[model samples]
Target: MKIKRAFIGLSVLCAIMLCSCSRTPGGIAPAGSPNGQASSQLPTATPASGSSDLSQSSRPDASTATSPAKPPALTQESIQIKLKQMTANEKIGQMVLAGIDGTTMNAQTKALIQDYQAGGIIFYKVNLANTRQATELINSLKDTNSRNSTPLWLSLDEEGGRVSRLPDELHKFPTNAVIGQANNEKFSFAAGSTIGLELRAYGLNMDFAPVLDINSNPNNPVIGNRSFGANAKVVSRLGVQTMNGLQSQSIVSVVKHFPGHGDTSIDSHIDLPVVQHDLNRLRSLELVPFAEAIKNKADAVMVAHILLPKIDATNPASFSKTIITGILRKELGFQGLVISDDMTMGAIATNYELGEAAVKAVLAGVDVILVGHEYEKEVKVILALRQAVKDKRISMDQLNTSVTRILTLKSKYGISDQKITEPNVAKLNAEVDKVMKLIQ
Candidate 1:
């Protein structure tokens, strides 16, 4: 698989990054102060909850350089313009994802986060906690970006049902496939609207929602009910409805596992699945919903870790340029974010080294690499990416193209304008009842 000539132009037109020099916020910090400095001496303060008293703490004496310097003023518009001036290498680094936990920040994660300058953060099961715990953890991470005065696109797989990270107390909706089976559009819209509201209220910017994979094979281990139905039209209608409801609340929607993973019996999480179908077969059976989503302006597309012998003999979707740029970008004309499903999983874990996949992924035209769980892994991936650009294995031009897409998603999600806030877990719980009723 080759990065075509057209791919080169993506770097110049959209790829970009920004250098943040302030006390880079959003790394691992304690509940209150990032460095664990005494709360009595907070430099600048933002309330975590609505009822909390909002007031600036007393200023520190000038002699106390230990005091927080004034929070550098950062607005979303300013960051976008600054990113445009960045180098391609920096831009590529910005698109890598380093998974993070709430309670503690590892030095390795911190270093990768600071240096790689990843575009977004995704939370996993291990990373979750109670509302207070989540609020503090995300707040601390957001602080690092705030120090740079750049808002980070904090993301989560709060899809409700089996995949919810934050629990029912924190909000969880019924699975989409469940909702879709109900054959009620109002029920679908309500469920989707609630999911959108809960996500945004938490300061999270994106949802890997409304799974477009049609679940054509009931025996398919990974994507069974994750899809709405066996029929493409039914899935498309529900997926688009879910996408619309989510975007209506300004929460960015990602229709995923793209080019489609519906009929395969193999589970990608355990091993890479190969779909041996021709282009026509894909368009008619699997690509139906994804094609509609691309036309509908879905903000991002999550590349599944499956391999398709028909599309490319060697590379899986994540590392394949043909799947991303050729089919999705060139053929479908999707000009949005391209993020990989977590590279930490066995499918990728069993095949390539983490860093190897990271570098190849960016070069493959993915806007971001999702690496959850290990910080050392994230760092290794980052350093590897940096070295590839240094060694000219992954061109600076290639890196820039992906970065541009990353920033555009951030700008569209409203992350730049809003601070990460505590999500309304209780409200999410109320919707779960509504969703369960419809799905049931």
Candidate 2:
């Protein structure tokens, strides 16, 4: 797999450009400030039932020099120009990551790309029947979406253990815990590269892997073995190596469950997990690996649904501008794509309607919202975003910033001059077997 030559031109074009940045409207107020509220200058947003209103949330002070320096703009030619060319529906489509019903390109799949113009497609186990079928399906999705000249991300949650979506015919390696236990950074790099090689062979680009969440809580239901280890230092070191390995093979690595999911006892998929730790505690532990991933220039970071009440009480991190924009974008200074954890998950879906959740996420500074499964709900999200943009509820500046990052990532890793090729199951499995030995 190789980076499309066309994207190299964009690299130079955006070299001098910078990502959109500013203090989120109302920066975080000081401790013991009146009512423990955000600055009065910030716009007030009423939180949903059982949600914290934006004004009531505790946000970081953007003025402090504690935040890292900002990264370069992900695009050139002003993403606004691209936005202007697109219809409101098209722009809305750019924000969605749609899921297909099956491994084949049926009518629903065709409608999603051709009609909906979805910016990306995420595959689950139900969509990977066999090597040939999966390859053809991915190519078909790409071909159909290419009609508009905008590439789509063929993504999957392939974290190499229980999280991997590929069938048994494809290789499956040890979990993150096993890899970390090996204590060899080189092995971790090889594991990530091997996964990338298999994904690339099938024409997929984006991989949501290298779970950056530190396994700090042993009782955590979802992240147990999936995490690298309980040590933040080990996770940071191994996570960066894995990210490098994936990008090295042209597979965009999305370091995930941002701000840390490993410490929570409840799974976000079933219920909202609240991390009671204050910002200082997060910086000391859970946030360490993510900071390292950002420092390594991770291509994308997947924000979790967990709420950090100590930081922002009213909204989950995925729906908080204070967390996404103020902290993730401004404080950490990540210029790469910021994708939301699946919107269909319980933490979000149970609390907010599809349209409401989709709108809030975009407004909160997310680039891509993954509406996995349920086409009806997916359509609702698209229409909601379209309506929001048309009504001016979602600003052009916000849309431009997100679409630029999405397009830049696509331009950088989504494009490929090569055609879909058959994966080497033997070679891939062999690598996994050898790597498994080290961990075993």
Clashes of each: 15, 1
Give lDDT per model, in order.
0.64, 0.72
Lowest lDDT sum, 10 consecutive residues, model 1, at 40-49
The digit string of per-residue lDDT tens for model 2 on 1-440 reads 01122222333334335323222312111122233311111111111111122121111122211112223323446344444555667767878998879778888878887789788889999899888788777777765664553567788999978898886796588788888888777667767766776776677778999899888889999999999999999999889878876775667899988878988988999889988998889879988899988877787999999989989998899889998998888989988888899999998878777789888989888989899988888888888998888899998778877877776665445242124556656766665676555446
RMSD of each: 11.1, 15.0
Q: Write the per-residue lDDT of candidate 1 for residues 32-143, one digit (tens) a residue.
A: 3344221111111221111112111211111211112232232344334445556555576677766775455655546555566666688776776567666777666665
Q: Give the TM-score of candidate 1.
A: 0.78
Candidate 2: Cα lDDT at 65? 14
TM-score of each: 0.78, 0.81
